[model samples]
Target chain A: MPTRARRWHISWLLLAAATIPLLAVVSLFVGVSEVSLAALLSGQDGGRAAEVLMISRLPRTLALILAGSGMAVCGTIMQMLARNRFVEPSTAGTVESASLGILAVMLLAPGLPMFGKMLVAALFALAGTSLFLAILRRIPLRSVLLVPLVGIMLGGVISAITTFFAYRTDMLQSISAWTTGDFSGVLRGRYELLWIAAGLTLLAYFAAARFTVAGMGEAFATNVGLNYRRIVALGLLIVSMVTAAVVVTVGMVPFIGLIVPNVVSLALGDNLSKSLPWVAILGAGFVLVCDIAGRLILYPYEVPIGTVIGIVGSAFFLFLILRPNARVA
Target chain B: MIELKSVSKQYGDTLVVDGVDLTLPKGGVTSIIGPNGAGKSTLLSMMSRLLPMSTGWIGIDGLDVTKTRGDVLARRLSILRQDNHMTARLTVRDLVAFGRYPYTKDRPTGEDKVHVDRALGFLDLQPLADRFLDELSGGQRQRAFVAMVLCQDTDYALFDEPLNNLDMRHAAGMMRLLRRAADHFNKTIVLVLHDINFASCYSDHIVAMKAGKVAFQGAPDAVMQASVLTEIFNTDMAIHEIAGRKIAVFY
Candidate 1:
């Protein structure tokens, strides 16, 4: 039986592994400016196709893969730490607090570089996630639904404050643009920060077993000689840093984190060490496909990746909630 | 030996375990039997270093529990609580393999696999080793948890109400398993038990607590008396010897 399970996981991993490159190729070719395979291979367009591939298409594709996998892994860690399936960066106010930090930097340090802005946003994300965890600890009635509901409420409150400030400063339009998560403007310089998020994702993979044990409540981890508090703190830092990097690079890509991990866990179990690779691959594929659809849906124009995933991810989230056999805690 | 010196646990103004000073000798099954709110579980938690003592100190062997590093102590001692709520969906093998974390840090070797298999065989969990924990019956799940604890291979094992959700037969089986662990493996086993009869039957030493203090501590024959049992539980109880084992009957 264990061997059968192992074979099943390997096949799924193989399928998932094959999917990302295919989607990346598709994403590279699907865009407003036509950069065909023939054109790139034959050098038929005087290196313009090559330039576009390097400057725009390749970076955009890399950003999608990096941000997608990063966010999905972030969600996995957050769910483990929170010990609830429904919690994610978008629901937990981490993204919103990151936006608030960006807003603060825009208003206070207008000349700050993009890296500086990302640093501040990551700091705020860390603080926001910690606050959410602190609140969860105080909440005596931590029903499965109530945890995410509390996170959503916290997000709403933070976004509302952000909106109020943006409205006063006449920066509402820019803030909306930043929060909506469009990858249309991703180029060589803009999307590189997501590599840091990817690095953090690798770190998460290294620490996956600890997170799995930590997910089994504090007493269980302590019995195994894990410093429970330290593991949780490390999980939060990874989650927040990933969220901030993705948000800073490409805005808020909602539900990829929430949906991808949930779907993977449904098929595979929640042993993060075994399942994280699947989560990362599936997440990248999901985002790449969504980005391609967003580009092709309106042809010359594009729907934002956030809007596309928001629609698809929310549908899955609702299904997860409404399903009879949903394993929630 | 497990030594407690003036150990107390206070929640606000209320003290749950009050200055519990006792010594449990190594290499035998010790049962802590008490009624509700007697702090048996609390004392067990403090002894295992799962809960910080309000005042005083606890030592296992020569190492102070509060001062010892977690991973170092983990190799020597292990504890299991009655209600272990986990969100991770794991196979029985996967769960039991976690017992090797103290040594392997999640990277299991050949020797660790041997230990895991032995534990599964000991608990008769080989058939269900591949099954997910949520797919198991309550008793099977309980056995799986016990297998994980056994796989830890610690010198001292502590359990808070190990038989909470077991049927009578399964509860007796669990008691026998603990007894065998103490007798064969030479492990120090301590348990918090509400069943006085089980305590009387299986334990080498019995300690009865009442209202945050130890009311009696001795062999089963000394602590299982009708007078001492009635005083500890505050109920009318009669002792009857069945097959040379003391049994308490309270109606």
Candidate 2:
């Protein structure tokens, strides 16, 4: 590694940190009801300003960044563990399976707490991932890429099931709207659940070295004296928990995890501990930038951050698929 | 010492390796040579506990390979199979550094780095330490993988066809590396080789296996006779001397 590039890399992290206050300020200032610089400085003469800043705007914006960063990091770890750039929580069907659990619970108990639905979804997602992995272990697939295909097909099945249940309940519109990820609802009590995702991301950072070793190969990991099964299981739990928490709070933001990690590793190698913080920061910054773009594009009215991220994320995903030889270091 | 007793492996109705019993002493190089479909690789897999044996016990230094904690055995034994394809793009140093994982997890101590440096230097990988495995020639990649296994610094090193893709000179160099690993490190090496001549020259003990059974096992001198080689290989063979070591010749 070049010394300058390494130093610049650390500096880039500082640069990302520097963007946080700006994102928070932008998030605080822009919304359907805006409080200008004058009002924010005055410490809120009107209750409207306080409600929007404390109860709605700040929480929603913080939720967007938190879940956004968490899901991206989760996606990064899953891709490494699965050893395929194409494998993400979305593509591996983890998100869809989690959606299935949430949908099932919503239909069964109309009065269930959001956290309860999230836990159920997390369980289902974990089960789906285990099912996918079991299929991977049994199939005589010559390539690791074949393993995630099973996840795609399985994800489709869960998505279908979720849609079917939603349609039957006459709540398909509401369900899909929530599931599609709208930061427009980034308000107080509801969005604070995203803090759970932030916690999971930190836990993932702490355990990153284990995840990187597990990524090499089962034989190599076992030879290194790691409890391969347990490490793998823990990785799956993190992926599922982070995915479920984010999905429950902010719905799904595709591709942040899938994209950021690969971009980081192009310079950082496959060491997860070295690359994870960058993945988290880059993810939050990327989402914040997109959210800012959404705010300014139409001025008073706004574009969905999810929609903006979707367009960019989809384009990047296509680039990954079309590149015959992926350059994920 | 490593012991395999009544070890058999079966896939459905197919008995791949059946009722093999062997005691391997803790020293030098032992080559297991056999025909194709003779269960050489599968047997190696069983001994390393990579593949679950159908019926048997594998005890390494008196600890059972199956029942023992994986990390404990990992420190004692290392195996390199043919065709080590990986998707991770890694430098030669990164790959060799994995050998220390059984010791340091991912955080390498200074001592671990020293082991990595020694392994890289041992395989002459210093010049190519920064090159990616995919960017290297097949023989070079093979050497890189060998360096990783050797860097593992275990008492028992097992290789399945260490010479599979090597050209003539590289193949001979690989044999020498194994020999040096055995002698200098005081490690026991068990290999599955296709070339009998290389085995005759480099191995302290020769193990001839056929149809999942041990056809012959003894010192290289005892196994190098024309009649013994012919019966074991099921082909006509001749022995010639290249500096006093018996070299098998058949053509």
Residue pairs with colliding backbones in model 1 are none
Model 2: CAPRI class? medium
Per-candidate total of colliding backbone pairs: 0, 2
Q: Rate the local accuracy (lDDT) of all candidates.
A: 0.91, 0.82
* Alpha-carbon RMSD of each model: 1.4, 2.3
Worst-scoring 10-residue span by lDDT in model 2 chain A: A320-329
Candidate 1 lDDT, tens digit per residue, A1-329?
A: 25687788789789879988988999998887889989989998898999999999999999999999999999989989988899899989999999999998889998998899899999999988899999999988546888889999998998899999999999999888877898999999998989899999999999999999998888888888999999999998898888988888899999988999998887777889899998899889889989999999998999999999999989999998889866543
Model 2 TM-score, 2 decimals: 0.94
Instruction: List where candidate 2 sits over 4 angstroms from the true fold.
Output: A1-9, A43-47, A142-148, A327-329
DockQ numbers for every candidate? 0.75, 0.55
Per-residue lDDT for B247 in model 2? 88
For model 1 chain B, give the 10-residue run with minimal summed lDDT. B82-91
Please give, for residues B86-142, the per-residue lDDT of candidate 1 as tens digits. 678888999999999999996878899999999999888999998888888888888
lDDT string for model 2 (A115-176, tens) is 88788889988988777777767877655456657778988888998888789888798788
How high is the TM-score of chain A in each model? 0.97, 0.92
